[model samples]
Target chain A: MTGTGSISDIEPRLGYSLRVNGRDHEVDGAWVGDSLLRVLRDRLGLSGSKNACEQGECGSCSVRLDGRLVCSCLVLAATAVGREITTIEGIAPEDGLTDVQDAMVTEGAVQCGFCTPGLVMAIHDLLDRNPAPTALETREAISGNLCRCTGYGRIFAAVDSTVASRRDAAS
Target chain B: MSVAIPETLEEALQVAAADPEVQVLAGGTDLMVEVNFGYRRPASVCALHRIAELHAQRQDDGEVVIGAMTTYHDMERGVIAAALPGLAQAGRTVGSPQIRNAGTVGGNLATASPAGDTLPVLMALDSTVVVASVAGRREVPISDFLVGPKRNALGPGELIVEVRVPHLRGPQEFLKVGARNAMVIAVCSLALVVDLERRRVACALGSVGPTVLRAFEAEERAAQEIDWQTGRLGDPAFAPEFGRLVAAAARPIDDHRSTAGYRRHAIGVLAERALRRSA
Candidate 1:
């Protein structure tokens, strides 16, 4: 809180115990109106989730809260006291990326990479819900997320590839 | 700032009754916008996230009571889609996916935005908005809740608890003319509910005036004079008259979205299209 100027203008410090990246941690200094995205990125130093739109219009700050796909930018830190948060930084193992992340790279879905974190989080949630989804279903699932760099053909392909790979492995 | 997060309706009522300055936060969709745009400032906020009773939807004997905090996305794909297609469409037409996930029916009603996609639909549905303050709870017709554009009849500590929409045998539809296909505000919007069984119709026009309006003259004309039962509606000649009547009902003003004349024209076309589509 030192480098961050004007603590008086912000909400007071509170405490939150959330299961993040499969580990439980006691995070203190929770503000009243501060978004869960801000707490995750600024407090816990998990900077994978982007804060492109403070409103819920953009999915750059998408995260999984209690296994539900939600825009962390719109959720207050105080409201997320007893929930579980899964961000992009938590997608990797102790060393490298998960299969989805690996597929994203293999399929060339990473362009400017600004929107990739949110897209990845949203896709992860979607895949968790429906491991094998139709193309239309996949489109509907990620309709909330916005990507400025690529034309989205590659990203769609990446998701489709992951779905195919997972199915192939299951067989 | 004090944070009063109540778990139940009674507890919420008690908290709201106790504090006259408490601003009601439902889903934080509209409240967040207000704070970001500096439209509202609250020293204390009463969060209604945990009020499970207000979110319940059940047939209480005869009428369907929908909890005011229900999200728009739910309306698009489920029970609401079957019951009230027009209202469900209105909910589906609101902001992007993220916004729809966060925005609530109560938030839309409380904002009182003339351009709110749900307002005209609610008005045509003749929905009842339940407002609870420290005194007690009372139901106001949707027409009355909309005092003006972005103006409402809510008291300082009042909270919109539920919006009960009467189930009617009708062909209902909602149409909007916005600047874009998605994530755009309405230039002019219309919601038509035709209860063919009762030989009456309810027409509401929004985003064209100070408030969402019921086409009283048109409704009366259709109810009292015109006979849809004894006549033919699917004929090609019916479109023009429907358009004219719908156009006559609107009171639009020129704004950034479109011209008044354009809105009037679009309203007529939309109304006719809505009717035809429902047909």
Candidate 2:
């Protein structure tokens, strides 16, 4: 990445700190044009968030910024300095997979697995907000996460099973 | 490139005013796409998400004043939805849950894409866009605010502060014809609004013109032929007439998403459907 000369001549490397997965990490010597997704995977060594479409169209880079689902690819690394960001790696338990993750494996929803992390993040967001989302709601929630394999039937099934299991456990 | 994350609107305005070439970042939905695609490489950026004033919303009299930073997710629920159902409906159709969470109404308006889902609704509602600079502020009507495809009336060193839309006592409807149900840009869209108090009907068409186009003749005809008391069309024939007139007002082109002929036909159908549903 060639710098613009004038701005880069003064400071070719910019430094900032970000709170990620309940931990603070200081990122140094990053370009101003780098996105949060780029910084996370390349600088912070956090690869749970996949960088599929750098544009906001695909949810492969989905993460929770301030507890709201957003594409990390669209977030400027400089702008996310003091915000709370939760990526797919942050959703797991200390020892086991989350309910959504477990269901994805059991229901054969991990065919290609490229979109799993983002799907997990989106599903977690949906169920966190609506414990019992309808089929259409489930589809609408994860519409951004595109999976070429499984035809999304198994994903939907996994979401249903997770919802049912959680309800039963609660009762 | 230099980046400034301003926490206050005044500070943001000062930064922006100091450098007219500085790019104002709001949600980074549209701008980031350009950056990612290598279409834009801004030398300086002024991020506004940290500013509290640009994220506020309030109601004054019968108008809904929505802060520029309000996201599509915000518009899908609560007071904004109740006050402007058409805007809410349009907002719900924008992108996906992830995109909606980060994409702001201000970004949508500032980007001023011809296919922006909410532009038609704002035009139909006669919304006013409030833009601010360190010098002062000014309100531009929605029609004048959108000058052309992917262009707006925002001046140098100016940033969108908020949008003020009249909360009318009426039934409003927004309809879009896209390639698919989800995550698709509109080929053509229409928003219809009936003001009960003023006994007026207004309609706006999107993606079928250089910018969002208001169907002035169709609105006038619908206003004249509709029964104010019953909130129904005085004559059923007026529905098709309204559709034809709305289609006539559109200046669509053959693009990758759709053909000019298809967009013209779709706009007419959507306009008719919107009117029928609202009535």
State which candidate has the highest DockQ: 2
Q: Could you give candidate 2's per-residue lDDT for residues B1-279 as a string of tens digits?
A: 578998899998899889999988998988998887778877788998988878877889989999999999999998888889998999899889998998899999999999999999999999999999988999999999999999999999899999999999989999999977778899999999999999999999999989999999989999999899899988877888788999999999999999999999999999888888877
- Identify the candidate with maximal lDDT: 2
What would the per-residue lDDT of candidate 2 be over residues A15-74, giving only the tens digit for each residue? 999999999999998877789999999999999899988988779999999999999999
The residue pairs found clashing in candidate 2 are none
Sequence-dependent TM-score of model 1: 0.89
The lowest-lDDT stretch of 10 consecutive residues in candidate 1 chain A is: A7-16
A1-171, model 1: which lDDT tens digit per residue?
Answer: 456777445545567676777777677765556677877888888888898867776789888776667787777666665567788877778788877788889999999899998888878877987898888778777877889888889898999899988999999
Candidate 1 chain B weakest lDDT stretch, 10 residues: B225-234
Instruction: Provide DockQ values for all models, in the order shown.
Output: 0.37, 0.69
Deviation in Å, model 2, residue B80 alpha carbon: 0.6
* Alpha-carbon shift of residue A48 in model 2 (angstroms): 1.5
Where model 2 places Cα greater than 4 Å from the true spot, the runs are A1-12
In model 1, which regions exceed 4 Å deviation? A1-31, A129-136, B37-41, B220-234
